[model samples]
Target: MKIFPIPCLEDNYAYLIIDESSGEAAVVDPVEPEKVLKVANDNGVSTVKLVLTTHHHWDHARGNEKMKELVPGVRVLGGSFDNVHGCTDRLEHGDKISLGRDVNILALHTPCHTKGHICYFVTGKEEEDPAVFTGDTLFVAGCGKFFEGTAEQMYQSLCMILRPLPKQTRVYCDHEYTEKNLRFALFVEPENEHIKRKLLWAKHQREANQPTVPSSIEEELYINPFMRVDMPEVQKRVGRSSAVEALMELRRMKDNWTR
Candidate 1:
């Protein structure tokens, strides 16, 4: 399986997951249909068989109808609980969908940013390493806002659900917020050398107009403050003792971030 990032409006991203064996592609959050289609064309995709939507947010799911009209007979998928536009198949937790022959996508419920937010975990036969499509629930160095749920839900989604995945699994989130997020991480953990170094790297990547996505679980553990909430140091920094409280405080800080 091959994954290509299609940079969308402002900082958003849409992805093309291609199964090499059959040339069948699964598009994730085709917010900008033309950009996605252009990426698909450039990649020589024979057919687009699936449209995987992570939530019902307009910026994420608004292009579903257009994509469906463009790619006739394509299966538009979204979380079962979400009122997604043009969703033909409503998926549930642990539901597995196969792309082509080897690229298997497992939908995991990761609600917090939205009550129906879901993340897709993808693996292929030929490709030993795996990749996860974390829409807005998890970012390169942060987690999404708790718009529809609480911090406890976000904790479960990020830690218990996404964090336990293979440490080597490449995390593909839906935005270009890594540089800003790392800056916030630095403020939260002033003495964290990992955050300092990652922030510098993110700066260089952005300076070159490059994407700072595909952050691994291992790297997130080291650099992401939200992912490290269970640690004593992170908890203390947030003026919280329990993991859930620490997570809540961290999120509040992120929400109030001005720069």
Candidate 2:
């Protein structure tokens, strides 16, 4: 299983998951159809299937109708059918979708970034680690903003839904925010060596114009300020004695951040 990270529309990402053996492919989060179609066509893979949406946000699902039109008879799978454009399949928790030989995706409903956000877990065929498509829910160094849910919901989604995944799980988020997020982490935890090291590494990756995604969940636990809200140090820094308050503070800080 080969996952291609195609960056789209002003930091947004739409992925192309290819099955080498069968030469079949699935597009995850098609923010733009032309780029996705061109990539798939150039790679000689069929772009007749898609994992429709992470949420109803335009930046995430804006290409749904165009993509369906570009590839007639395409199967558009999403979390909800009501608001989703051209949704042919509505998926929920514990649903498994097959791409090709040795490629199976398990959808986990992680609703914090949005009320209907879902993450896709895909295992690689060879020695490669498993990959997760965490659309707006979990990023490399930061989680998505709470647009439709609360901090408590985000806590559960992180601590429960995403934490249990294997430590080596590669997180493919929907944006290239690792560098910025690491900067925010530095502001939050000036004494954290883990964050400092990650920030340096992320800077190098960005300098080389490479994708800074597929960050391990273990790394996120150590460097991401949002995931560290449960830590006593983070609670103290946020001027809060409770984990919930810490999370709220972190969220508020990120919301007001300019740089």
Candidate 3:
């Protein structure tokens, strides 16, 4: 499986997952149909079999109808929620959707950013390592704001669902918020040299007009503050007893933090 991160409106990202042997592809959270089509054409993939939406946010699911129009018979799959427009197939937790003969996308219902948000875990024949399309639920060094759920929900979503993925599983989140998130991570753990180094690397990547996404779960475990709410240092800094409480405090701080 080949993954292409297509940069869309400002910092948002939409991914294109291609099955190399069959040349069939699936697009995740397409904000713009033309951009996705162009990328598919450039990669010599003419058949787009599926359109997977992570959430109903405009920046993520706006191009669903247009994409369907562009590519006839493309199955639009998303969470089993009312707000997801153009969703022909409603997916739930643990549901596996097959792409071509080898690629399988497992839907994980991680609802914190939205009540019905879901992340796609991709594993297949040609992939060297599995990958997860986290949408806005999980970022490189941060997680999304709890727009529809509480801290407990977010904590469960991050720790129980996402954190347990294989160490090498690549996280393909839907934004370029790494540098800013690392700044917050540094504030949460001032002595963490790993966070400092990652911030510097993200700065250089941005300076070179490159993307700092597709971070591994292993890297996130070391540098992402959201993933460290259960750690002693993080809990102490947040002055919280439980993981959920620490996550709440950290989220509040992040919401009010200035770069």
Candidate 4:
């Protein structure tokens, strides 16, 4: 199994997950149908399936209708509240969808940034390099804002929904916000050497016009202060005791943060 990162419009990222053995592929949050189609054609892969969206966000669901037009009878899977352009499967928490012989997609209801936000975990594959397509719930150095839910929901989603995943799981977020997020991480945790190193690496990657996603959960746990709101250092910086309170403070800071 291999994942291709397709950057689109501003900062949105669309992923193309291909099963090498069967040549079957699934598009995760296709931002543009033309790009996805071009890549699929160039790679000699067939788009027989698609994982539509985690929510109704325009950037994430915009290309679904057109992609459906290009690939007739493509199965589109998404959360119930997504209202995807060409959705065929209405997935809920704990639902599993088979991708190939042993590859399967496990839906995790991680609603906080949005009421219907869901992340997909690809499992039962070779290489043991499992991946999670977290639309906006989790990022390389940060998480999404609390748009329709509270910090409590965010904490539950991260601690309960996402944190338990394998430490080596590669997180494929739906945006190219690593450089910016790492910058903010540096601001929040100036003494964190891990964040400093990651920021330096991200700076070079962005300078070279490269993607910085597929960050491991272990890396996030180490450097993402938002994910470490329970720690003493983060609590001291945010002046919050509980993880949820610290998260809220961090989010409020990011709301005011600007590049």
Kindly give the stretch of ten consecutive residues in candidate 3 with the minimal lDDT sum. Answer: 79-88
lDDT of 4 by residue, 91-122 (tens): 89998887756678888988888887889998
lDDT score, residue 171, model 4? 93
* CA lDDT of each prediction against the hidden true structure: 0.93, 0.84, 0.93, 0.84
Off by over 4 Å in 2: none
Which of the two candidates, 1 or 4, achieves a greater TM-score against the reference? 1
Clashing pairs in 3: none
Candidate 1 off by > 4 Å: none
Query: How many residue pairs clash (N, CA or C atoms closer than 3 angstroms) in each of the candidate models, in the order given?
Result: 0, 0, 0, 0
Between candidates 2 and 3, the lDDT winner: 3
The RMSD (Cα, Å) of candidate 1 is 0.9
lDDT of 3 by residue, 9-61 (tens): 99999999998878899999999889998999999895999999999999999
Count clashing pairs, candidate 1: 0
C-alpha RMSD by candidate, in order: 0.9, 1.6, 1.0, 1.3
Residue 235, candidate 4: how far off, in angstroms? Answer: 0.9
TM-score of each: 0.98, 0.94, 0.98, 0.96
Candidate 2 structure quality by residue, lDDT tens digits, 1-259: 8888899988989999898878888898898889988989898895556554777788888888888888887787777522666678888888888887878888888887778787888885868789888888888878888888898989888878887898898988999998999999899999999999988988899889888887888888899888888899999888998877788889899989988
| Weakest lDDT window of 10 consecutive positions for candidate 1 | 124-133
